[model samples]
Target: MSGTARTIEFDQPGGPEVLQWRTRPLAAPQAGEVLIEQSAIGVNYIDIQHRSGRYPIASFPSSLGIEASGHVLAVGDGVSDFRVGDRVAYIHLPIGAYTTHRILPAARVVPVPEGVPLDWAGVTLNRALTAQYLVNDSFPVGPAHVVLVHAAAGGVGQLLAQWATHRGARVIGTVGSAEKIALARAAGCHEVLISSDPGWVAACRALTAGEGVHAVFDGIGGAMFEQSLLALRPNGVLASYGTPAGPIPPFDIFRLNQLGSLHITSPSIFTFNKTTEALRARSADVFAQALAGVLRTDTPRLYGFDQAREAHADLAARRTTGSIGLSAR
Candidate 1:
């Protein structure tokens, strides 16, 4: 298991151009670890943040990427849950998935079900787990709830919308433009609004008969923070999970009380699935949703390992929809 691996690394955080391909030595898995030959790697907005230094990495010569899927090549001692040749996928914290091979703790790996494609698992696992927590644990969307999902045509947004709707919540989605409306609607949004519209907030309020929605899933941070707050009803929860637009600006805490005692929380997937048992339980739900047609399993747009820059460019420019991934082969 000692060999070379092709990886995308960056010496400094800047832009997409900072990502460079290089050959690095690989070693066998240590105890409680598994060596994997990756087939697909996920591309997420967080990856863009890491590239641009919006989310700083600890070192200069750092690898970026948190999710990938492939087959187990070897397993270390005390790892009997997985064997060589088992299809697996993982999403973990110490970013380094943008490589052809890697060694990860067995606790971090999940078995990809037989009918699910490795590519789909690679690109969708993180997002699916995110959606699971948002709809189930964050605010617990239900039949009586009316929720607003921002950037509904995007990766996690689409999954979130669908999962909320499946839970019987009335989902209203917002997209950057009218061009993305159909995709948002297809993802089970009962209504889609153009986010750029000056009256979009008014429209959302109108849709809820002026009472406002029961929950607001706002990923567009600063630009939409106040608006998301305005879209919620009394005691409604605003889950501020991401900030692809920009970090939320500081505002008076009293605004929550002024806005009908509303509540705001920033939820993280890592926190939701912090333990091995929690991770496996949550991943099982995602896999069951995909297998049962509650979550879509379509193939996503992919980039070759050499095109990592182009992939980041497309994702940051908002030129792609759904999930996008990288091919290791």
Candidate 2:
């Protein structure tokens, strides 16, 4: 609180090399906001999208972290639920989590349970909330349903697989490598396959006895989006979340009719937690599951705050797995 906070920022839109570390005097939180000294920061794929200009931003010269965990240093007027020294984490925010200290809306921060590690809180809230909505809202998965998740070993992938399994759904996953298959299986996937394999869709059909899955979670868009449609049975749902391979090409509505009257929706965390009540409910489910051990977060890879650039590069290159956290001061 005595000195300026340092953060990584990019003045021009480009690759990881554009991120630079700089310092600025820390400011007190405004009304309904709280100032936190971050203990850990989460590196997500969305950050890569923002950096590569795939996800358009209205402005530049911004810091780049969607979520993090830390203790409250001070609370502004009218804030009551949190106090100084409270452990908390949040998601769906503008650029700025890539710093040692920040001021965020008080409503966004949720008190974390003692059982959840600080670094785990940093990475879990966003991805876990996503899984919560996907399973509970976008499509209600149940014991009788068969769910297929793309990028099963990735952050959201692992969480979705675990949660779907808890709901009694037969959770299957698609990964890029054999090692990732083991990781996905450990995360409660009933079956795991390589997404790039030529016969992967056939394998999915074989698993369901030619019936296909009840739902397909399509994160790798582009041509894979069409393939996901083919892997669904009648009245199946297709949740196309991320476009790591780039956005899917425009298609006709009749394509859904052709593909068993399947339903497709693209969801973002911002729309899921649009209200304070929604945020409370979503974060509560996330922390409760983490506390009860219903969903196990894999050991996160640690990168020093200064190594943020390297972390981004690794994440974009697909050399990193699970969550990547930056240790804050």
Candidate 3:
């Protein structure tokens, strides 16, 4: 391992501009930990939220990021699942991935299989794994179910649409404008509608022949939360997984009651894969699908490690498609 690595850290939380590189000393792995030489570092809205202080957990001179793909450079005591030179990808809390090297718990790391590229594996986890739980377990989508996914053109949204379609469920998707309609449709949205359509909700109702959808998988958590509720059938589920349009403002709990006795949940991927065994299994499942070509992220948007700020800006502007990551070099 190198004596020092180029790392990104900021004393205060704010915009992407707050991120800058510094030569930080690299430490060896501790027990059950593996020191990784990072290759593809990922950037997501969650990283933006952390960088902007929306969650406010980072301390002075703090690090940020939790997704990346790399090769194990060293293994500390008790780490038997990995050895030097094994390619792996990992995601976890307490950020440290905005760097060329990282040290993380072996339990949180999973091997990258033969067919999936390291960059693809790096960008796939946050979206693919989230999609996995959303379809397979969150509300247990099936053939008979009709669902709506907000921001359907997004990496996660596309994956959700693709997987839900494969499950025999009919997928309806929401996008901000007409230009994105085709993108969503390509991702398996049986029908796509502009969220701004005067009768978008009515359109959903009409699409389902007034029966409404079985569930609404929403990541644009804010106004979309309420709109999503409207698109669901009685006893429908609304999974509020993100807040790109800003955090959902406080609202009445009885709103659900008023809206057809609906069920709403804001589940996190972390909670879904809390157990090491569960994480490994879910990771493997998503990885297998990627290798099988069921999930599409053929060419990820590439960014230099120093261009982190630009990357965040592009994401915040909604100008990105497919998986996006920073190259360690």
lDDT for each candidate structure:
0.93, 0.87, 0.88
Error of 3 at 249 (Å): 2.5
Residue-by-residue lDDT tens digits, candidate 1, 1-329: 66899999999989899999999998989999999999999998889898899988998799999999999999999999999999999999989999999899999999999998889999999999999998988899899999999999999999998899898999999999889999999999999999999999999999999999999998889879999999999999999999988899988999999999999999999998899999999999999999988899999888999999999999888888899999997
Clashes of 1: 0
Error of 1 at 266 (Å): 0.3
Off by over 4 Å in 2: none
Candidates ranked by TM-score: 1, 2, 3
TM-scores for all candidates: the values are: 0.98, 0.97, 0.97
Best by lDDT: 1
- Candidate 3: regions farther than 4 A off: none
Candidate 2 vs candidate 3: the lDDT winner is 3
- Over 4 Å off, model 1: none
What's the number of clashes in each of the models?
Answer: 0, 0, 0
lDDT tens digits, residue span 1-329, model 3: 45999998888888888898899888989999999999988888898998888878746788878899999999999999999999899888988789998999999999998888889888668888999999887789999999998888887888999889888899999988788889899989999989878789999999999989999999998777778888999999998999999878888999889888999889899998899999999999998887777787576777998999999999899888656888886
- Tens digit of per-residue lDDT, candidate 2, span 1-329: 46799998898789888999999899989899999989889888888888878877668788888899999999999999999999998885676788899899998888887878888888767778888999988889999999999989888888899889999999989998887888899889999989989899999999999999999888778899988999999999999988888888989999989878889999888898988888988888888988777888556887999998899888777777677878987
Tell me, what's the RMSD of every candidate? 0.8, 1.2, 1.3
Q: Give the range of the ten consecutive residues with the poorest summed lDDT in model 1.
A: 218-227
Provide the lowest-lDDT 10-residue window in model 3: 293-302
